[model samples]
Target: MSVCRQAARQWSPFSLGNMPLYRVCGIFALLSVGLISFTPPCDGGNILVFPVDGSHWINMKILLEELHARGHTMTVIRASTSWYIPEKSPLFTSITIELDEALEDFFELYLQEHMRLQREGGSAFAFFKITKDFMSMLSTAHLMWSEALGKILDDKTMIKSLMDSQYDVLLTDPAMAPGVLLAKYLKLPLVLNVRWITSGEGHFAIAPTPLSYIPVPGSGLTDKMTFMQRIKNLFFYSTVVIQQKFMVGPHYDAICDKYFEGGCDVISLLQEADIWLFRSDYVFEFPRPTMPNIVYIGGFQCKPAQPLPADLEEFVQSAGEHGVIIMTLGTLVNALPKEVTDEIASVFAKLPQKVIWRHKGERPSTLGNNTLIVDWMPQKDLLGHPQTKVFIAHGGTNGVQEAIYYGVPVLGIPLFFDQFDNLLRLQERGAAKIIQLGEVNEHRLEQELKELLFEKCYRENIQRLSRLHRDQPITPMDQAIFWVEFVMRHKGAPHLRTEAYKMPWYSYYNVDVLLVLLTAVAVSLYSVFVLVRCLCCRSRRKPKTKQH
Candidate 1:
């Protein structure tokens, strides 16, 4: 059994005060010692990282390089995904293959199946059922990916390839739950690095409460269940939980059994990590509720400002002081409908200032001389340029962070998911204006861009937040490194963990306890009142009879 399981079994509800405190402390202390002993000093050493290839992987690359420069020997396990390019640099000590051709083929098949289902017409009920099934299949695919990763770690030949490398710490993205298993199997301290707002709390470090359990922040919307949405959110939560339970739980168990000779809960396995690091500034994600183990190290991915390419810089500078507008929809969702693109192009054609759009394909022939389209651009370099006035973006977290980092006002055309939330937050902070994806037209785009270019307050507001962000005691990277090292040195600090796990659903909200107490008091008072009434009636009847 894992240490957490042992502690849970030993814990007594009635004798909470007289529990074996020393043993608990001893176990935690020993774990802490083991973690710290394995952790190299702040100077950095061998660190093994698992690769999750995507646009977000870019951030990890910067982080790895920063640690490498500080003397860390960085090794990466390359997962074959189109999102990551393994040949980008020679920083990795060794790249281990984690994906098989069969799995890749299966994933492609599943994707095609789901896409076909989406394209086919069906009844409303059928559509809902199909979507749910699709989500389930996608979740299973993710689980399969996690299991495959675990199998790779379990392989003796694979272990031989990695074990000879003499790595110190294992760092990974939290989404890859397999990382937690690998860390446990290797008995290495794990550092969970989150790239976006994850927990329910927007920015507060409080324990996660369900979205329905509290009012949705900023929107003033109470998740008061309207029978339907409640059921939907519940279903959503259940689907996610079930997926995690099946995928993460078994993989964790298998890894533990193979490596640690023990069994453990997936949650405990995750929480057993030394530290949880968030790559976000508190100002942007304020009111976020998280566990004590969680730390905010936002902007760690941000680097010192770099100059733009000479020709591009010259073109932007020569825009005759009106300055150029920088627009990008980010990497994943670049393929906007032709109508949307035409509308965007139409708006840009009329603008006096030059427009530099990071479009994926060929520039439209109708676009004016002032407009430039490129397949890719150095985003940060462009953002930092003084001649760059307004930003039109898809409102990605990294883009939002960069905009705030440089104090550039944004015109956000949020596409989906947290992009909406990020845009909402930016608008609430007076740092940007939002144009819904569905509502984007030439008129709307032109008007919003005009307002953003002319608005002084927007620029000022972003600058204010930028100042606040920069005023942090240390850079996010330093803070992340500190906590990561802290966890390794201290072992797992259970003391820092909150009582969230111990509380029942009703008790967590104090609803059941309050209801029970109220019911008991009401019942007791009613019984007493009834008894008094009976006595009075009997006394009155006796008096009346005597008089008669």
Candidate 2:
């Protein structure tokens, strides 16, 4: 509960030393006036947010609450597919809608197939097989979500109410086509809540992603690529571009057509986005060209470490000089193969350091006295603890950023998706080490853990990174809030929008410029050669006509 709510619940004349009723009421009135003074200006307009109904919702929560606290009337249109719900606040309201039944069913089937393939030792063929199915699932779900959103928009009364509300801005997750389409219909300035640093297909639509250095998120390549590695990265990046263009783009375009009259392309809305608040920072990410509209809110979800529960604190301190290691694979990954978990437990038992593994499944029999198996652990709090020696993780963007914030060196065991790329980059930066799941074994896990724990270099690198992350003039969250209101304050801040969004693909890449330069050089070379040949022929003819 908020402080205001707590005070209201405890407020009473009797509690105030038996003061006169009028005096108590006067004190209450003064407190109320103070609270009113703290409230944001009444002129703050409504801001509507539409987030995809999974982990993406978790990513948007902090920013949403901050906006509400600043006196903006915020409404979030939620989908029924969410695994968790945000805490109820009087300042923010939510409207829930169910996804298509077929989508729900397909998602279950897709999850099963995906997990099955991932567990079967992620071979090259397994990678392709899972990628194909995941793409198909994405297309089907996107279409169904679009249809579900169309129904909501088709409701005459809802449309009337939305139009009447006069919402000033629409913030949305770029992955959701429905949200983008709705923002267009409402004719509000759009802001994207991109919750990851790695450049994905959706991000490619809004900004220029150079293929030379920036590797695709899921591709198992680092920024510093050899010639062959560069070619491989290029192929991988190009394939994603093609898939988004030929496959995802057309489906979303059709979705827009259903409700948007003459219709619109999804990329059109992305191009018009006033700001792209990325969950990224330069400290962790490779240096890349960024536009003015891009805002980095990397550690917005992180906060100062609070006191741990007594039991956890006692357990952590029991390790003494050895310290503690926190291991978690993030929210989506709940289980590993029992054999793999057993091997991990075996590895943990041999280590001198105490281990806290956040396992969501049945505990393995190989568990050690030094290891504590918990269904869920406060990950950030554990990492922030001074006794923390190392962090073993799946190398998620959030997890990696947290490790950096707390100065914990990571031993990444990447399973799938962007985990590989994230870990690879960290390894390149000397702050972390990677142990691929396919290569994970007792020996490997133990070896990497030892390196991560005892190595002065690893700790030094992360501490340096921590300094860089903290040395910013303003906190990332405050910077994000400033820019969010900056958009509204300046009516979309048109000056911040880059000219890159307005250019065609060929023009943006300077293909036309290259073509013109090549053409001019070729023409000039040909003319010079022809002129020389003519001069030679004329000289030969003059010699034949004279003293021959």
Candidate 3:
């Protein structure tokens, strides 16, 4: 039935125009290389997935695809208002919960406003405004998600169905923590496909982060910090803590109180996870303390390059020796501010390289014939291409990982959120250069672009990273799968999970131990002082007796 088998059965060597033995051997080589595939057998397991609806879903979907190929059944819980998480898919069965309105469009409206504020910002007042606006938006998003989660809980039939399904594991993105709640409620082994947790970066929730060295996400500092920078990092970290404690925590508190016996705190629940498939590697991330259960499976989504489409191939080939430059701002943003785009486009026009930019909205007036603008691109393939010289991007996790995978240097234009932090990692490694939106102009863009392109260090550094990433004993994807299935093989991995979450804050930090030790030391010191005083008094009394 197979092509190789069919060719073998036909026995066409004599019929093929008197072919030589070497040509016949070449046919066998083709069969061995192309027609043979060794697919490992799989044990089909049921997996329940809860994913956030935007860029987070992309990673979740890729993981699900791999699991599905390995004979796993998947069920996804999504919102009716979700544009990205469709109601139907071949890979997973969907359970769509209705929402009052689409949240994705709501987020985009605010994204535009944030970009506008960032462009206009020059003073402390402007920074305060951005932080205020972001917190308001975050609270609203949490409020909506919490309400939607409440709907799922209130449904008796749906609850019964989920319980009856008896899923082996619940795979979730913890950015939106309803999945975590569901996993706990169902008592399934929780495996998080995570980068961001409920309040901030995932590490802070589960790992012991020393503020002395490990920089906070938005502080824009590296592992090595100055005195003032350490103070600034602490301040930034406090804001994240306050957000989780005061603002976002309250949104879910009501639900937890009503549903669970012991009222659940989401952060603690997150720390109790059986496995955290963290979406970062130390090669790309700053070195920090990590837990036993946390698996580093960064760049799991990347793979070898695929052939380019005919038209795109022709365009790339036209660049010849100068090579091509690829620029994209990720899924959330369609376009940058007009002035910024005009500046970037103008600079691209002046360069000798070919450009492929993924952009929407108004085309820049200064567009060049060398540059091609499209609504979408085969991002990974483009990065993998030999002709791709440098990447100009927004510094999302996916894009950054891909750039590292393919050994491409970047000139980053970080707009908002963790984009700056993500890009800063590469800049620290000397693989990228960053230009802010507020600072963008023809001169800055041209200078950075040329530096990234012509400077041999940028290319060399990223390539070295690529080697480090590739030299692992096992692939990241395989490592992730092994862990996921390991969870399934054992009902849970509580052995690896630390009991640190259950301990009180005082006990966890050893404040109680410190207090006991301090008290004992003080008591011993006081006794020694009293004995010494008595001895001195006796000596004085002896002298008085002798004089009498």
Q: Highest TM-score: which candidate?
A: 3
The whole-model lDDT of each prediction reads 0.68, 0.79, 0.92
Sorted by lDDT, highest first, which candidate order results? 3, 2, 1
Off by over 4 Å in 3: 1-42, 531-548
Better of 1 and 2 by TM-score: 2
- List per-candidate RMSD values in Å: 16.1, 7.9, 7.3
Identify the runs in model 1 with alpha carbons over 4 angstroms from their true place: 1-43, 85-88, 101-141, 160-166, 195-206, 210-265, 490-495, 499-548
Model 1 weakest lDDT span, ten residues long: 196-205
lDDT winner? 3
lDDT of 1 by residue, 1-548 (tens): 99997687667543355657777677779989999999976555668786455656777888787776766667777655434547446677656454554434554455444334433433576456554654455456456656676677668887786667655678887555666667776677677776422222222223475656433432323335465655566665564455456633564555556656556555665556556677666678645346667788776767667988898888888798799899998766544656667778888889889989988754565678889888888888888778888888988778988898888999997654356667777787888898866578878888888888898998899989889988977888888777756654565455776665556668878999899999999999999999999999898888433553
The predicted structure with the larger TM-score, 2 or 3, is 3
- Candidate 2, after superposition: displacement of residue 521 in Å? 7.4
How far residue 51's Cα lies from its native spot in candidate 1, in Å, is 3.5
Residue 11 of model 3, lDDT score = 81
Off by over 4 Å in 2: 1-43, 86-91, 102-112, 195-203, 509-548
**Every model's TM-score:** 0.73, 0.85, 0.91
Pairs of residues clashing in candidate 2: none
What does candidate 1 score in Cα RMSD to the true structure? 16.1
